[model samples]
Target: MIKRQAREEDETHTAVQGCLRDLGKSLGYDVWIAANDRNRPLDGGKLGDGCLGELPAAVGQAPGADAVRLIDVLWLAKETGRIVAAFEVEHTTSIYSGIVRMLDLALGPEAHALEGMFLVAPDGREGEVKAQLARPAFSRIADLKVHYLPYGELKANREAIARFGEGMKPIQAIARNLV
Candidate 1:
């Protein structure tokens, strides 16, 4: 039962990642899938197959490159390689890790310029997410304004947003500001 539940959770996370990938592309950003998650089939090919072979800027410039690499999804500016937004889908995994990854990106040299950072999880997890964010260790994340996007919300509007949305505004509208 535990194994089955874990598998289902992983599938949900993957589906969320795939939706983010599609939305990023539709909004004209080059999407990057985590190196480990690249193997998962999404759309017509592997998730990482559709992503850039390398980060526009080497993610390893900072000490958190390893953590940053596994960020569920990243929307980067195609020409400049600047990360426009970073997302971590916390389906059933540790929210602590997701927040930590956001911190890695937030503490990077270009932190101030990032357009957005988000934690995407199940709708019911909002209270858990809020409580976790309240922890002292996540102080920096709170300051950085990590947003929350529920799975149901993403799934509900992704198609319309993909087809008609002009830029990040549509996504932002759906994402709840965590802090």
Candidate 2:
């Protein structure tokens, strides 16, 4: 039962990641799924085959290239080649790691390129996300502002947002300001 529950949560994580990828692509951004996650099944193909072959040159050259490449999903402006947003999916794991990754990206030299940072998780996790962000260890994340995007909202609007939404504004409207 424990193992089954874990698998279910992991599947949810992948589904959320796939939703993010679709939204990014729909918004005309160059989506980047984490290198490690590129092979996961999505829409009848591997996510790796759906996203960029490599991290954008700009991000790959950044200070935290290694960490940056591992972000769950990144939406980069097609022309500017800079990250428009970064998302870390925290389905059943501790939220600390995802927040930490966002912090690293927000504070890195390419920080200037990031317009948004998000933590995607179950809707019930919003309160938990708030509590975690309130920690002193993540004080810097507060200043940078990390948004909490509940899976419920993302799943509900993924298709509409992909078909009708324009830019980050649409996504931002659904995600609550966490910090």
Candidate 3:
């Protein structure tokens, strides 16, 4: 049962990534999915920081706040020449409050680096999550975007899934979608 659940999680994660890639393509951006467990040497091996130790304090502070860190998907908006829009996907039935806290940390810095920050959830709870983000504390943060894509949307988009699952080459799939 444990292994089966793990496999399900893997499938879910991959589907989320595929949806993201499709969305990025539709928006004319390049998408790169970060490795699930391999953190860059910098940022103390944090998943999002690409440079070794040069990331701002905001990016590194969330771990201590009990936030669950997942692989960060980076998107480069071609029109803006900006890179590193970090996104997180949540499929857990019970919402994790720490995720909002972590977004506060990650977005502060990522907003400056990329076009915007996005939180993708498939459980139909995006409005509530966006409301939480709209609080004054998180409002001042620039270029933050919230979107919710139902699992049905993903399943309906067979071309995108095939492109994403063709291999481990998600980046290539994203590039193809752009063209």
Candidate 4:
């Protein structure tokens, strides 16, 4: 049962990442899936979502580039090439690792005014995510205004938003404020 549950969670994680990638692309931002996840099947294509071969010059040259590259998904501004948003689908894994990865990009040499830094996870885990962010070690995350994107919310509205949503506004509306 435990193993089956784990597999289920992993599938959800991949799905959420795929949803985010599609949403970002439709909203006119370039999407990127984590390097390790690129080959995973998603949305009729691999999880890489046909992303750029490398991180944009803006983030690629910044410190912690390696860590930032591993963030579950990113939405880059079309013109500036800056990362407008970063997401880590926590699913059933350690939220701590996701937060750490977000922090790496947030605190990197380049000052990124991310439109949203989200932890996409199961709705039941909201409290766990809040507890982790409340820790002193992750204090900056609060300042960064990291948010929680419940899988239910994303899965439910992803299609409508993709067709009619403008920019990140619609996506932000679905996310819960954790700061």
Clashing pairs in 2: 38-48
Q: Which is the winner by TM-score between candidate 2 and candidate 4?
A: 2
lDDT of each: 0.85, 0.86, 0.47, 0.85
TM-score of 3: 0.47
Give the per-residue lDDT of model 3 (tens digit) for 6-53.
778766755566556555555455555554433423324433333222
| Total clashes in model 3, counting residue pairs 3 or more apart in sequence or in different chains | 3
Q: TM-score per candidate, in order? A: 0.93, 0.95, 0.47, 0.92
Cα lDDT tens digits for candidate 4, 1-179: 99999877777778888888888988888888898888887667777846766888878978888889899999988787888899999877888878888888888765455778889988899998889888888888777888899988998999899999988888899999996
Query: Positional deviation of 41 in candidate 4, in angstroms?
Result: 2.0
Q: Write the per-residue lDDT of candidate 1 for residues 89-113, one digit (tens) a residue.
A: 9987779887877788888865765
- The TM-score ranking, best first, is 2, 1, 4, 3
**Native-vs-model 2 lDDT?**
0.86
Query: How well is each residue in 22-113 modelled by candidate 2, as lDDT tens digits?
Result: 89999999999988888987778887666888876767987878888889999998888888899999987898877767777888777897
Where in model 4 is the C-alpha error above 4 Å?
1-3
Rank ordering of all candidates by lDDT, starting from the highest: 2, 4, 1, 3
Each prediction's total of clashing residue pairs, residues at least 3 apart in sequence or on different chains, is 0, 1, 3, 0
Please give the distance, in angstroms, between residue 33's alpha carbon in candidate 4 and its true position after superposition: 0.5
True lDDT of residue 161, candidate 3? 50
| Candidate 1 residue spans exceeding 4 A from truth | 58-60
Residue 5 accuracy (lDDT) in model 2: 95
